[model samples]
Each structure stands twice: as structure tokens, then as C-alpha cells.
Target: MMSKNTQADRNPPADKTAGQTKPRGKGKKYLVGLPITVWLVLIIIVPILIMFATSFYKKVGSNIEPIFNFGNYAKFFTDSIYIPIFFKTLLLALAVSISSIVLGYPLAYLVSRKVKRFRNQLYMLILVPLWVSYLVRIVAWRAILGRGGVLNTLLLDLHLIKEPISLFIYNPFAIFIVLTHISLPFVFISIFTSLEKIPKNLINAAADLGANGPRTLKEIIIPLSMPGVLSGFTMAFVTALGDYIIPQQLGGPNGLMFGNLIVSQFGYAYNWPLGAALGFIMFGIAVLILTLSNKASASEGYLE
Candidate 1:
């Protein structure tokens, strides 16, 4: 019996089907992911590739010439108007992102940490505007900011002014306000999610250790919630950066952004190559921002 057991240990029975078949779960996963992969390639990768290819082409007398050149990229650096408008747009986008964070953080903290009974109601209120049509919201803001609109009417009723003021609409300031309002909800949601993810035990532990509320927040909460802050900031920055519609409607002459230039190149100018190049530049900036944000979040370790 000992000799037989020793032989069995040295040489186990060989399974006939060993290594002949693959795991069903792995094959199933690949099969399931195939459609999504194809869809992504079709919608995203293909368009980007086409755009990249087009960026190398040339435009000649209202027709796109298939000529390959670096003129499109060169023009961005050579043109006097493009660089200034791009810098201005960058400043505006930065301002919008900062404003969203400032306005959203406190509200997010209040709702996520302080509120209990009416939490859902307040959350819904914050999110409700998102369900409305973006164009409708812009139009509504127009009505509110127009010459004889609600703001001026209110001031008139309160006897605070003699007539309606044109101070509110068709300006960069109006564009800023509209962009902030649009971005605030997204920022709030992000911060609130981050706050919610904090383990209650951590707070309790801090309290037990005699750390006060402010100290606890400073020492523990803020550090943990940074990933969400970065995420929200990136979202707001990108949203404001690519916005042409808001600038067109509210920005007036001074509101011309980099997006407007890109739009014109594609639209009336019939310069697809230039437009593609400009779009790729903005796309590169966005990708860089996203990468930096991801790295920052990774450093926070809360994201892990």
C-alpha cells in the first residue's frame, strides 16, 4: 500500500481534456465586450483618425485639396488672432472651474454631511436643472437677463433703479455666469459623492479621539475628498473650454473664443483641415488636463 501511494504521488493520472479547452467565462467575457469594442472604434477611434488625417490636408479655393502639408498646424502659431483668443479662452475656462468649485463645495458639504430629513429633496433640486433642455435653459437665462426681464423688473418693483439695466446680458460676464450655473450641479454631485464615500467609522474614530469638527474635516475629510474635487474641476474646465454656443449667444464681440475660430473654419470658411488642427489642439489640451487630474487623484490614494 505504501509503495502504491508513493507511485501515485510521483505520477498522477493525466486528464484527457487538460489544456484542450479554454475557460468558458473568459470566452464569454470577450464575446460580450466585442460589440462595445467595435462600437467604440466606430464612433470614437474612427472619427479621431479621420480628423487627424484631415488635419494634414489642405484647403484650396473653397474645396478641400488632398494635399498633405503641415500648413494647418503652422497657421495656428503664425496667426496673430488665434493665440490671444486661445489664452483668453483658457483664462475664462479656468475662472469658470474655480467659481464652480467655490460655489459647489459648501453646498455639497452641507447636503452630504449636515442634512438628513430633506436630503433627497435638496439633491433632487440640485439635479433637476440637468433634466431640462440645455438650449431651453440658455433661452430662459436670456429672458431673465434681457433688458426688461425678471431681474430689472424686480429691481424696478423694489424701487432700486429708474429703468432696466443692460449690465447683465450680451457680455463675457453673462457667459461666465451661465457657464458657472451649468457647471455647479456637476461639481456638487462629484463632491457629494466623495463625501458620502467617507467611512462613518473614521468620523466616529476622530470624535472618540477628541478631534473637533473642523479639525476632523481638515485632517481627514478634505484629504480624502480631493479625488472628487480634481474630477469635478477637470469636468468643469473641459465643459467651459469647449463651449461655443454660450459664447456665441452671450459673449458679444469680446466673447469670441477659440471654439468660435474652430467653428468658423469648419462652417462658413470651408477650411476643414484648419478646423481639424484647431480641434486637435484643444483635444490635446483636454487630454493633458485629464492625465494630470488622474495622476493627482492617484497620488491622493483615496481613489485606489
Candidate 2:
């Protein structure tokens, strides 16, 4: 017969330590995330909520007085001035999106399929301008496109024109050019990532099945890469639409966009409610674009 002590030794007590460890780990994770959660709530969410609240209130004298009326929103619809600028902004955004997609797709494809070596080096080259300050780039463009600037100087020296052209700077076209140049790398990077995800064996199999280069790219590559294209377009469009600085600097009196008008309301106009309403409208449009693009991308994605 076994002793009482022997029976007790065979079965040790269940571990309480293991049970407590999971809860401790969870607590630690929450502790790490607390700062980020607090910061976002205080900075982004709070400000946005305040802005939304302020949108409903009217400006009384120098004070933002509270009112529950749809007059601000109503003005946007009835007033012809704001509506045209808003549509113009949308049109400009669409143009910028198309231009980015067209320019990015080819460069991304080249890097992914054709470049045998120094591929990363090429990517770094594309990213160099991005790392520099955005304001610096805008200023640089201003200098380059100015009447007596680099392009004109070169043209004048080469006897291409009798005088410097005033057509280059302080115009909508200049805004378009600068925005495209800066936003190009973002689109390229997104598309490049998508291209990299594609399997090499698919291309090889297509080739083995008697598919030519153009045929493989047409049916296989382009279909698979549409998501990246959509992403790039959305990014470019949103960035271009929300940019007040670019339009302010480059867009002349006739070329003033929706963003500038919104700024005017906040500045000397002193109409906080109106500005907030316009901002909300702009945000809503951007969100709508993103949502629609996402749906389209999702529908197209399953084919792969």
C-alpha cells in the first residue's frame, strides 16, 4: 500500500501562475495602446467633432454664436458662386487622378518586370523628391516656371523664343504640373507593391501556353493590377482636392479653386459656420469617392 505522502507527491497542485499570465499580458497590451488612443481622441476626434458642432452655429459679431438652422448648408446649394468652385475642384481632382494613374502604371511595370538590377536604387531615386519638404518642391517649381526662370532662361539662350513667356507660372496649369510631379511617386509605389505580389509562375505558364508578351500582359497582368491603380487614383485625387496651398500659390484669380474660397470664409470673411459647412461638403465628396472606388476594387478583385 502507498503512503499518504506518496499519493500527495504523485499529483502536484494545479498551476495558478499560468491562469494569471494571460490577463497580465492583456493588461500590458492595453497599457501600450493607451497613449495612442488618448492622443487621437484629444487631437483628431475632438477637433473634428468641434468642427462639426461649429458648422451648425452662426457667427454673431466677432463671436461664433450657436444656432440650429440649415442656413449654412442651404447657402451652399442656392448660391451659385460656391457650387461652381466645388465642381471645378472635383474636375481638377479627377484630372489629377487620371494623370497620376497613367504616369505611375508604366513606371511601376518597368521596375517590376524589366529592371534586372538596381531596382531598389530606382525606387530610392523616385522617393528622393518625396523626402524633401513639400513646400520646398512648390517653391522650386515656382522658380523654375517663373517668367525669367530656368526654362525661359534656357529657351532664351538657345534662341527658341524672343522673350520669356508669361504663360508658365501663376496659373491652373502650373498647379496641375506641380501636384502631378509630387504625387507621382505615391501612385508608383502603390502599383509597384501590387505588381510585386503577382506570381512569376503565372507569367511563365501563360508564356508556355503560347501567349505572347502583349497577350499575357493584356489578360493576366492588367486584370490583376487594377486594385493598385484604383488605390493610386484615390490617393492622388484626395490629396489634390484638399490642397489649399498649391491652389493659393499657383492658381491665378481666374483659376481659384474651392479650397481658396473656403479659406476666404475663415479669414477676412469671418464666417466660421460657412467655412465649416463647405469643409464638410468637401470631406463628404472625398469619402464618397473612396467608398465607390473601394466597392469597384472589391468587385474587380475576385476575378484574380
Candidate 3:
């Protein structure tokens, strides 16, 4: 019996399997991230570096040179033409954002709360315009708002005005209308997501606690959906601020945005450095606004 036990114990230690070993320290974690790291460096990091480098150069007699001058930036701040255009663009973006929110919230709430079976259908309808080419949409609006367009015809039939209003086309009003229509889906979708996240139990709980419909909405639904509202407004604002095509097509003269100015600098003006500077300035302004909005949301206890 002792001899048999000794033999068995001697054979047991003959081999240890590879699967029995513990994993080594930090095994290949960075390797998994290598592709993403390369992509970010290629796409985002390199472009930003190029933009920064370009901002310091100047166009001199058909040649772009690395002058290391602040002339571009200085011109941006001191030039009367560009500065006012920048402010106008900011105001226009703000107006578009606010108007989109005002018009979108109610529609989103109604779609989310009131429509159950047709919710997907309604969402599809809202998003259908996006599937069409953006240029086509702008052209369609132009046709509808033109002098001999549907609006003018309706007004003429109704006798609202003796003549077709030029204000309806090729003006700031046209820009505002087109931009708001383009941005409405974004706001609506954001708010719809927030509305969907609200628990029915919370509404029931509020009702049971003797809170009326308006009180429940004001105290609970509105506060809970603040993050989505902020996100929607931010998206709408940024889109409106950067949009050049809509303003260019629908806007006669005063509807020009900073985007138009930037494009002109890069195109006919041949002022690459100034365009780069303006782009950076716009980036800084957008970052500042987003940061302030985030802080305000946090202060209001709406951010997690």
C-alpha cells in the first residue's frame, strides 16, 4: 500500500497544464486600443495641428508664408465689417435655437405622450425631410416662398396684402424659417428621448400625492427633461451658427452668417490665415458656451 501511494504521488507532479497559470500583468490592453489611438491622431489631432499652424501664416502677393504675425487675429477683432457679422451670426444662431425649442417641445411631448401606436410613423414623417438632399430642401423652400409661390398665392386669395410681401423671400425671415425647419427634428428627437425615459410610476406617484396635472408637469417632467432640452438647444444652436448654405440661398444680404464670411475668406478673398483665425475664434466661442451651459445645468441639479 505504501509503495503504491508513493508511485502515484510521484506521477502527479509530472506536468502542470498551461491553462492553470494566472494571466500576466496588463496583457495586451494597449494593443486593443491601438487602432482607435491611430484613428484619433490621424483624423482629429493632425487636423487641429494643421489649423493651428495655418493660423499663424499670411497670404503675401500670391504666396502663403509662415510670418508668425497676429495680423489675422487683430483684423478679426478690429475690423468693422467682420466683427459685426460675427455678432449677427451669434444672434441669429441664438434666435434659431430658441425658436426651435419653443416649437419642438410641444410637438415632442404630444408625440411621446399622446401618440402611442403611430409614434414610429410620426417620427418617420418628421425625419423624412432629412432623407432628401439638403440642397433640394432649401430649393423647395425657395420655390414655396418666392414671389409667385404658394404663400403669395394664398395671401393674394385671402386679401391679406395688396401685393406679395418681399419679406417672405430673400430675407432674414426666410433664413430664420428655413433654419428653424431644418433644426426642428433635432430638438424634437432629443426631447422625445427624454420624455420616453420618464417613468410612468413617477407620474402616478405625483398624482397620488395630490399634485395636479400642471403641477406634476412643472415640478417633475420639466425638471427631469432639462438635460435633453439643453442638448437639443446646443445642437440647434451649433448647427445654425455653422450653417452657410441656407443663409446664402434664402438670405438676401443681411442674412449672411459667420460661416459665409469664413467661406468668402477661403474662396474669393484668398485669406486663409484670417479664415483659420475666425474658425478658431468660433471654436472657442462654442466651447465657452457649452461649458457655461453645462455648469448652469449642474447648478440647477439637472445634470448627472
Provide TM-scores for the models. 0.90, 0.87, 0.86
For all candidates in order, the CA lDDT equals 0.88, 0.84, 0.83
Query: Candidate 3, residues 1-304: lDDT per residue as tens digits?
Result: 2223333444434445544663555657677678999999999989988988898899998778999998888888788888888889899999999999999999888888889798899988987888988899999998899998888989999998789877788888899899999999999889888888766766787788899989888977787777778878988898888899998999997777899888888876788888898888887888888887777655543221
Cα lDDT of candidate 1 equals: 0.88
Worst 10 residues of 2 by lDDT: 1-10
Between candidates 1 and 3, the one scoring higher on TM-score is 1
List the pairs of residues colliding in candidate 3.
none
- Name the lDDT value of residue 86 in candidate 1: 95
Per-residue lDDT of model 1, residues 1-304, tens digit only: 2222333433333333554565568789799899999999999999999999999999988789889999999989999998999999999999999999999999999999999899999999999999998889899999999898899999999999998999899889999999999999999999899888876867787788899999889977888788889999999999999999999988887789989889998767889999999999999999999999999987774322
lDDT of 2 at 227: 82
Best-performing candidate as measured by TM-score? 1
Who is ahead in lDDT, 1 or 2? Answer: 1
Model 3 misplaced regions, further than 4 Å: 1-32, 298-304
Give per-residue lDDT, candidate 3, residue 101.
94
Clashing residue pairs, candidate 2? none
